[model samples]
Target: MGKPTGFMDYSRQTAEAAAPRERIKNFNEFHIPLSKEEQQIQAARCMACGVPFCQSGMELMGMTSGCPLHNLVPEWNDLVYTGNWEQAYNRLAKTNNFPEFTSRVCPALCEAACTCGHYGDAVSVKENEHGIIENAYEQGFARPKPPKVRTGKKVAVIGSGPAGLAAADQLNKRGHQVTVYEREDRIGGLLMYGIPNMKLEKHVIDRKVNIMREEGVEFITGANVGKDVKTAKLLKEYDRIILACGAKNPRDIKAPGRDAKGIYFAVDFLSATTKSLLDSDLRDNKYISAKGKKVVIIGGGDTGNDCVGTSIRHGASSVTQLEMMPKAPDQRADNNPWPQWPKVCKTDYGQEEAIALFGHDPRMYQTTVKEFLKDKNGKLCGLITVKLENRQDEKTGRMVMAEAPGSEQKLEADLVLIAAGFLGTEKYVADAFGIALNERTNVKTEPESYETNVKHVFAAGDMRRGQSLVVWAIREGREVARAVDESLMGYTNLGA
Candidate 1:
């Protein structure tokens, strides 16, 4: 625990973000971290509550309430407060494999469930975590520690996202020979491209990947399994195969003129920009150009917001975001009590940039694209959008967003980005592996197990659990690693 009365004595403070306008000029991490001393002070604010829900990864009201990795938030906070940097890092590394990735991209469900946050500000757990990890890297504490004894059990992990990386790290730590396969040219599946650089710099991923490589984990990039690499070969070569390829099937927008030239999937647009940025610093003109063009993004989730920010960085003339759901309350609703994930409106960094540049919030609530308008040459020109209202479905007994009859509107749009989310794992990957898919299209596994119907083959992460947070994927990875270790060696001591 931290100082007994530190929550009362010290106020909560976090890293300051660079102004949106200034940061829009280049794609880089914009959050300036707090000094070591300031971070220690912030860590001191973790109150010694008898029950710390901040680390309790429980679901309440059908929403996750805290860190899915079940990170030892209070313990690490106390270590940070006591200036025990190395120990803090050790405690952090116990449960979560990639604190760097979580600290940057996580929504901080831990903070939302913090006891102190019930009445006042929550402890700066995420920032404190960031400080600890970054400081560990700065010091010599985070050096590679390859296992001395090799069990000679080879594990082939398909995909190099957080889940795959975590499984590879843990299994390797347990003396299993682990090899990671990535379809993309680089490691870090979504971490490398799905997320924009302004949120998480690519170097952060590379740094940890280098550490993994040094620790005896083998990584093969540009290996597209199912299509290029044969599953039967992997089955014959490796002792076990763990499918962590992630849910790569993007849900498409179906409407008239859907084949227009100027429309692109959000993932494709983001991936191209990042690939080009890494390859030639955007000098190659390899990405979809938003420069001097009007942009409209469908699906008002994180990906949609990312599109808004990316477009702004590309000097978009104007940007608009279509959201099918109504805007959430500015503050937590009475029904949405403490400890449950707050169902409130959050203006993320992307939206902030759009507002600062456009002088207005770009989101249109309860609106959806009715049709894509294209020119004679098959180029996207504009779009027809319709307002939606919540209506009760008679047979289903559920609320549905139905179109409002007289609320159609037309807007000029030079480009459209569909961020409508994913359905599940790609069919080709599943079919090639000879694995069954659940109703949701994710890899089918028995309840509370990573074992697939196929013997010696396992599944984890988004491929098994559907599209989810990076932290959840890491948790799955760790759990699957434990399962594989236990299966390989009659009994194992790896933490889940």
Candidate 2:
């Protein structure tokens, strides 16, 4: 441990975010990171417990507890405290493929399971991680180093999200020539378009991608495998193929007046805004505009909150979010103990902006859209919502959300965005490869395996495991790379 009493000596600290109203004027990262000196103080707060649950990546109560990557949290935190940032970056890179992305987007599951947090505030592990990576970049320690030898094996990675990128990075490091194919015009799948710019700037992705290119990982954008590119060609050309195409099918709301105009999927709406912002800074007016409209978003997940924030930035008159589940408690319940994923209410950036602008929270818990209201022109004018209550099923004896009678209400909504989440992998990609899918629609694979039923083909990430966090996707990528390597060379020494 860097300091035996460090946890007691220093309180928890993190990067500061801009005021909600002030930051809504533009789409840019708002967090002001702590200085190196200040970060060292925060890093010292890590107790480096004898049993470091912060890195355990285990499951508890049907939710992930710590970091899915199983990051060497204590080792790097000590390095940061001792003024060894280069070594900290090295230790971080040993497990996590992209600290830059996760440091910003991850929910800090490590902190949730931190020993210090059992009573007091958790050590700022995520900020320490961010500092190490950003400092590494400034010092040129993150430069690419191509492999010295070639195994003469070829691999094709479909999708360029975290999973595909991690897989390609690992395989390329193992001296295999790897090429990544992205269906979109850009490399990042969800990271590029699905996620808004304010949370993670695009230049960060480009920086890492450029380094991977220098390390001999070829990326082909606008190449939709299984559609534009033939599956047979890939099967014949490459020694193995890894499918990292994420879960692309968005779950839709089935309700009355579903065909009304001005309603769009959450990903489609977010992607349009990002593409337009990147292509011309919104000057071309080629994207969906929420300006001067009363927006209603379905689903109270991260995507929905992102829509709320994006709409506020676009000058929306008002915004509302509907969540079918009951509101989580402000504090952890007796059944919810330390080291488990905390089920609590969290007001994200978008809702914070809404509160600052509208003088109230935008979410309506235990509420769901019952029907869409349209005018004579077939444009979405409003929505009817109904309240829900928890009820126990007689057959299954499980709790379920059931509609409460006499609770329907209508609200003005010029634009509607569905952020209800995703179903599974798209049919075309699975059909083109002729791989079998499980009941959940994910590519079928044996438990604890990444290989598919088809020979010389494997699956990973959301394509293999449905909708999930980016950290989990990266782990799946690392594991899939190891599997592919073993198939290619009979044995493997690659890390998962």
Candidate 3:
């Protein structure tokens, strides 16, 4: 691993960011990087603990615990600690295809499980990871290392999200001709649009895609299967097919005034915002202006945080985020323990900015939006909310919420973004292909095998599982590649 005393030698450090005030003026990535010299010191902080849990990727207490891609965290950390970044990059690429993407957007389950983090702060595993990948690219080590031999097998990867791209990367690296089909105009699904530029700039996606293209993976955008393209055609032409289309069916609010014009789904808002930003800049008095409007965001997940950050940059007159659940404890609760994703409350960048700008955090817990109020033109005007008390239902024997009487309140909101989360992949393509679906409506496929009921067809990632982090999608892609390779060659060395 790393130097035995390296963790003690260097106090944990991470890359800083552009001043919020300065960076908020534009929708671009804000996090700044440590210099190469500074980066080396940061990487050396890895304790390289004996039973490294960084790559365990276990699911405990309904949350994932480490890198799902099963990256050689300690190996790479040791390599970076010794200033041997070239070897570190090679080791990293053995599993992950797009470290640059995950390094930025991933919640960093690996850091939460870090051995050094049993007490105080965890080593900056995330930032150090970004450092290594970024350095590898800068040093020209990221050039395409295409497969030496083509196996003459063809694979079609549906969806251009992280999972699909990862599967395509692994399949192509095994010398299988891989063509990725995306329904959107761009190759990346959520990475290209669903996320805001400040969190992950599109240029970062373009950077890695360029390398993948040179590595012999083909990307075809704006081709929707079961519509303009036929699923049967792909099933006939390709030796194997993978569904990485993603879980896109957004959950909706069924309360009164749901049809208000200004009330939009979080995915729609985020995707539209990113698309508009890329189109030119969705600001100014003429754009989809959140400027000077009172915005209310529903849901308290990462998507909600993104909306909060984006709204702040748009100069919203005021912002309030609502969470139905009670506020999480500042420290891990009795039920939550070590080696688990802590269910604790900490201010993310958005909340931090809101606090810095306003006097306090713009979040309210144990409150639910009852209805949206609108004006004559049908544009949203405000919302009615009420406090709720946790209660147990005698019939169902399950806990539910009951509104606390006389605790209702009204809040002005011209824009309301619902970030409640997704259900599963939209059924359009699945039905068209006649693929079996699980009760949850995710594409039905055997775990690890990824094979659907249809022969020669497979599924992976969000489309097969459910909406999850980019790291999980990457892992699915890697696993499914091995599955498809095994089906084709009757054997596979592609690690699942």
What residue pairs are clashing in model 1?
none
lDDT of each: 0.94, 0.95, 0.87
Better of 2 and 3 by lDDT: 2
Worst 10 residues of 2 by lDDT: 1-10
lDDT of 1 by residue, 224-279 (tens): 99989999999999999999999978999889989998999999999999999999
Clashing pairs in 3: none
lDDT of 1 at 306: 92
Q: Pick the candidate with the highest lDDT.
A: 2
lDDT of 3 by residue, 1-496 (tens): 6778777888887778777667778887888888877877777778777787888999897888988888889888878878999999999888788989889999999999988887767877888789889999899888889899999999999999999999999999899999999998877899998888888899899888888999899999889998989988998899999989999998888889999988888888788788778776764233355788899999889999988888988899888999888889999877898789888996888887787777789899999888889999998999899998999988999999889899899999999989999999889889878889999989998765699998888999999989889998889989899999999999998876
Per-residue lDDT of 248 in model 3: 94
Each candidate structure's TM-score, on Cα atoms with residue i matched to residue i, is 0.99, 0.99, 0.97
- Model 1 sits at a Cα RMSD from the real structure of 0.8
TM-score, ranked from best to worst: 2, 1, 3
Clashes of 3: 0
Tell me the tens digit of each residue's lDDT in model 2 across 1-496.
Answer: 6688899888888899999989999999999999999999999888888999999999998988988899999999999999999999999999999999999999999999999999989999999999999999999999999999999999999999999999999999999999999999999899999999999999999999999999999999999898899999999999999999999999999999988999999999999999999999999999899999999999999999999999999999999999999999999999999999989999999999999999999999999999999999999999999999999988999999999999999999999999999999998999999999999999999999999999999999999999999999999999999999999999999987
Between candidates 1 and 3, the TM-score winner: 1
Model 3 TM-score relative to the real fold: 0.97
Model 3 has an lDDT value of: 0.87
